[model samples]
Target: MSKTILITGASRGIGAATARLAGARGWAVGVNYAGNAEAAAATVKAVEAAGGKAIAIKGDVAEEADVIAMFDATEAAFGKLDGVVVNAGILDVAAQLADMPVERLRKVFDVNILGAALTAREAARRLSTGRGGNGGSVVVVSSAAARLGGADERIDYALSKGAMDTMAIGMSKELGPEGIRVNSIRPGLIVTDIHASGGQPERANTLGGGTPLRRAGTAEEVGEAIVWLLDDASSYVTGALLDVTGGR
Candidate 1:
């Protein structure tokens, strides 16, 4: 039988890519979106076209009720979840630490760190065998900025991603005995609209030449890594911070 997976922020970018790839692998997918119903719907169609079952679920990861609802709805649709990707995150216009307002920092941490924590918490509850659930996997989408630091820009976003890395590490140990595996992915410059949202539409391409690969990664590349972590093929892997950074 095929496995079931829920991907938060699946309307576009890395989330969408992962949904499609998982679908193609014959997994049922819950495509979760915060507000863009159209994009979520599009992702649903894409998943179905890729030959897997799918449903578009609307929920804000930053809201506890919404995160719970998203997971509840997914379980309702697919029976149970075998994996979850905590992929929902946000970035603001790039700015140095001093130039960034307190409100901006709050928004960044609220969605990136708190949101991820809430989603991962739900995953732990639903996937843990100790909680009357089957064993499963959880993948947190972090960023390379966690290691390099955003430096001149987006230090706040970088810090938030760093928290995600730590969360994955800690959860892996906490959840391991429960039969649930947890891992994190740190992606480098990749072509995604997130940069546009961060006020640097050309950031990925501009920085691609500096990487050893001399090109930015595609969402599909990162998606492949996530799917590997979620699949049984990587059953022995946990507490790993996999970098899809193309040797950055």
Candidate 2:
């Protein structure tokens, strides 16, 4: 049987790329989008074109009820889930910490940190051997900003990702014996619409010249790493933070 995997925020960027790549690899995909039904449908169509089964799911990761329903829907559509990519996240316009509003901080933490934690909790409950699951993997999409701190750009986003990094490390040890693997990927300067959402459409291109590779990475590059973490090729790896950054 083909493996089934769910990717949150799959309507665009790294999540969408991962969905397409995973489909190409013959994995049934559950493409979850926050609000872009049109884009989600497009992703589903792309997956089908790649010769894989796919369904678009609508849910906001920041909401617990939505998160629960999203997982239930994925299982209902695919019968079983072998893996998941916690890629749903958001960031506001760049600003110094002092200039950032509390509302922005709350929103960032709620979606990026709380949202990931909730998703992982549900994944563990369903994928753990102790819970009667056959075993599975979870790849959290974090950011290089988690380590670099994002300084004056978006410290809230950085802090949220930092929380994900710690969660991956801690959960890996806790869930390893339970037949569940947890890991995180920190992508650096990927050329995706996320930059546009953050109010800097050319941010990646502007900063690409400063990286050691002298170019921003692509969503497909990060997608490849995310899928690799979910595959058996990385069976011996867990609680690891893989960076898709170009030597930044």
Candidate 1 pairs with clashing backbones: none
lDDT of 1 by residue, 1-248 (tens): 59999999999999999999999998999999988999999999999999999999999899999999999998999888999999999999877899989999999999999999999999999999989998899999999999999988899999999999999999999999999999999999999998998889999999998999999999999999999999999999999999999899
In Å, residue 15's CA in model 2 sits off its true spot by: 0.2
TM-score of 2: 0.98
TM-score for model 1? 0.99
Supply candidate 1's per-residue lDDT for 149. 94
List of clashing residue pairs for candidate 2: none
- Against the hidden true structure, what lDDT does model 1 obtain? 0.95
Worst 10 residues of 1 by lDDT: 92-101
Give TM-scores for every candidate, taking all chains together and pairing residue i with residue i.
Answer: 0.99, 0.98
Across 126-218, the per-residue lDDT of candidate 2 in tens digits comes to 788888876889999999999999998999999999999999999899999998899999999989999999999999989988999999999
Error of 2 at 210 (Å): 1.5
